[model samples]
Target: MNLAGLIFVLVTHFLAGRGVMAMFGIKENKRKTLALSMIIGVVLFHFLPVVLEVCHIAITATSISIAIGILTLALFLPVSYKLDYSVLKITRPSFTLYEALFATLLILMVIPSVWLCYYFPVFARDVLSGPEPLAEYAVREHTLINSALSVDLTSTNNHLKPPFILGLQVIYKLLVHPFGELWLSIMVCSFLLMFYTLIRERVHALIVLFIMMLFIMMPEIYGYMYIVLSDYPNMVLFFLAFYYLGKYLETKQANTFYFATFLFCLASSIRSETVVLIGLIVPLLLFSFIKDRIKPGVIALRLGILLVIPYLLYYVWMNVFVANYMHIQFNTGEQLSVTSDSVNIFFDRIGIILGPMLFSEHARELFGYIFNIFLFTLALDLVLWRKKIGLQARVMLYGIVVVLVGLPLLGAIIPWFDINNTTKRGVFKLFPLAAFYMANSPTLLQLSQAIKRFEFPELTAQKNAAPVMAQQQKIKKKK
Candidate 1:
């Protein structure tokens, strides 16, 4: 591993992302904005290589470094606009003993995950054949359209998938590590921090820690944290996209909505199938706009923005790049199941996905009790707080449905989309949403408030007395 190169790449991304957040006016607290900056930087930098390739520039170390320098300077050009250092001024919150323990446990898990990512060679078959070799050769040859494309890849279409993974791999392999997957670790850590920031504000610190523990403990999801695959990265971007979308719903902030759309575009760039899922989200966005009583023209325009961007990305990759640039005859129609029993096949796939694949003993081994906890929390909410369930929670539930149904729909349309491999990993998209919903659980929120009251009784008493004192003062004034 090129330790110095890794540090340089990470720092450049952090600073570049920080500059972007500042330029766009996407304000959060210092910590959260920092986390979001890192994530946004990772996704945005993917396009640097794409731009180079479009211009027929070789993806060499010097080229990439120069590009980074140019982008960084461009972002930080406004020297007079002071960067946000308010995080330094804010006092840190005191953690209780239990919160400290939970933090320690999460740190322990993260350390080993990073180590494993650094230690292991590229091993996933999908990656081994596709992005891994392509990236390895692209680094060696300094061109993406290299000798790797000349080989016979009749067995798998993985090579024809979007260049998002290839772009990251090329950058990382050149600048970070030989395996080029430390980007995954960067992504994982940034996402976890941002997630913590989001949830800690709404739930008790202790409960937030517990939720983070459950998230890190999921066997399938945890393994992917280190493993180099597109699914986990896709899940991270997709989840963040919706998180921002929820923020848009709450604040009606254009920047927030555009950020969500940008993340969704990044997610789509990772997997072509993501376009379908984005389509599923359109109705939700449209309904929200209607309820807000926004003009039909503006509503249509915003919905168009959400849907068009992803489709344009999809077309660039699948239609333009793959067909013209690579000269590959990649056909989606050939992958579809057109048999008379296609409907039955779709329903069967759905049943398998929601049934044994979700709840069976084997699934318990793969996912542990995470799904069970989500279902239980969801049922509890439905029974006790169904009417009280807020739009954000409902939006999460809507995402859960979109993924669950969208996967089977994809399987039905694309013959090779199997329940075991593709569908299994596709289910990763749901876990983060589940975690978000769990964070918003009303019972959990109430419990979080009770815990806070118990932990700081004096503060609670002060709060309780203030209202009473005000009432007594009013009576005295009336007399």
Candidate 2:
């Protein structure tokens, strides 16, 4: 039954994704289209229950299932009529022996992580205090329950946090009944698959697979995979937004732009802190249009509608509905004031927080080694190929720097919690992007090219020698 529910949910997302891709006329790249579709589908699925709740409709399992079914059919029908079935087929790519071995190694590494999601208990403290109670209340009550008003569970002051993941849990509970843990596994696996699909375009298949291993093996990343936390979901959404933005820059495709904007908004909705991505993304979009000598007004209008409007709506909704219900106030007086001591502490902890070293003893044991490896790779890439880095990569690097620097400043100003831990996890939100850019760095690309030259020197020589030999023969004939 658990397996059935998983399959059902996965298929529904795929179909809905394909429909979204078709609607946007995104047909150039198959893998990207499929990946973006799945992501958009998940976002829409999350929003469906919210819309129902807002309309004063009951959110029972049966109603949710029927709504999803109707949406799937509505989307699939037109897509089927318009798109050729062959476009959806997944053809296998031929691989060299080295590639095959690396691919196998990648798969082996991921299997343990996926298995851990199933075998390990859902034990993240934040999950128990945060999303779990919300999911339970929503599923049990057949409506969105006011956490502050509910007596059954303690509210964690996260009522304004987006409900996308909670809505997913509700659907999973309805479908699978009691097997809640399986849903966590499924969500984690889905993220891995999407990561692979997005990365394969920029890096070699072997390198892409290796990066996946690195991501899942990271203690911080895999720890949250099975836990009902918002961090992993926010990571996925941030990566998706940037992935599409990179695509838009490279291909100058409007559909990719639309997708990027949508994902950005969704990411901000998932985590308020992710609103910072707007500052990182808008400049890139403007640069793309200006570089292409395209009018910026059109880009500005589209962004205003797609990115700004959605963010504003979510902000207002959070303030009016969720915040009011939870008795939370959003005011300037609540801001944390900066002091000399706070500044000193922020500077002192900056190394542990933004650096690769894990500060917590338990987290250090689990994630220390993997985090150091990432740090080494990042340092190596920047030192060796700083000049060869592409503009898109440079933008991402700048964004990372801004995040690392800006977050500490925020922590200094607002001494709300342990600045060390806050900076550690907060900066972690940029890990996927950091790893991705590092993997596709010019140094890595040059290394891969050199490896190809060494492995197939004969092929390389034949191509180069052909032109020289032709010239020599021509001289001999002339003589």
lDDT: which candidate is best? 1
Query: Which pairs clash inside model 1?
Result: none
Best by TM-score: 1
* Tens digits of lDDT, candidate 2, 1-479: 46676677778888887887777676746655555566666666777677667667788877888888888888877877888678657788767675577667757765775666556545656655655666677777777654524553433444445766666667777776442455455445566666666566666666665666666677776666655666667777777677667767777888888877777777777666566446655665676677788776886786686567556856765776566544556552365686668777667656656444454566565454544555676677779866777866765666566566556666666655454355556666667777777666786677667766877899989989999999999999999
- Residue 134 error, candidate 1, Å: 1.0
- Predicted candidate 1 versus true structure: per-residue lDDT over 386-479, tens digit per residue: 8878778887888899998899888887878888898999999998999999999887887888999999999999999999999999999999
Stretches of candidate 2 above 4 Å error? 28-35, 74-80, 90-122, 146-148, 152-155, 177-183, 197-210, 283-296, 302-307, 323-352, 355-386, 412-422, 466-479
Model 1 misplacement above 4 A: 76-82, 88-93
* Model 2 C-alpha RMSD to native: 4.0
What lDDT would each prediction earn against the true structure? 0.85, 0.66
Q: What is the lDDT of residue 164 in candidate 2?
A: 65
- The alpha-carbon deviation from the true structure for residue 153 of candidate 2, after best TM-score superposition, in angstroms, is 7.5
Residue pairs in candidate 2 whose N, alpha carbon or C atoms collide under 3 angstroms: none
Cα displacement (Å) at residue 336, model 2: 5.9
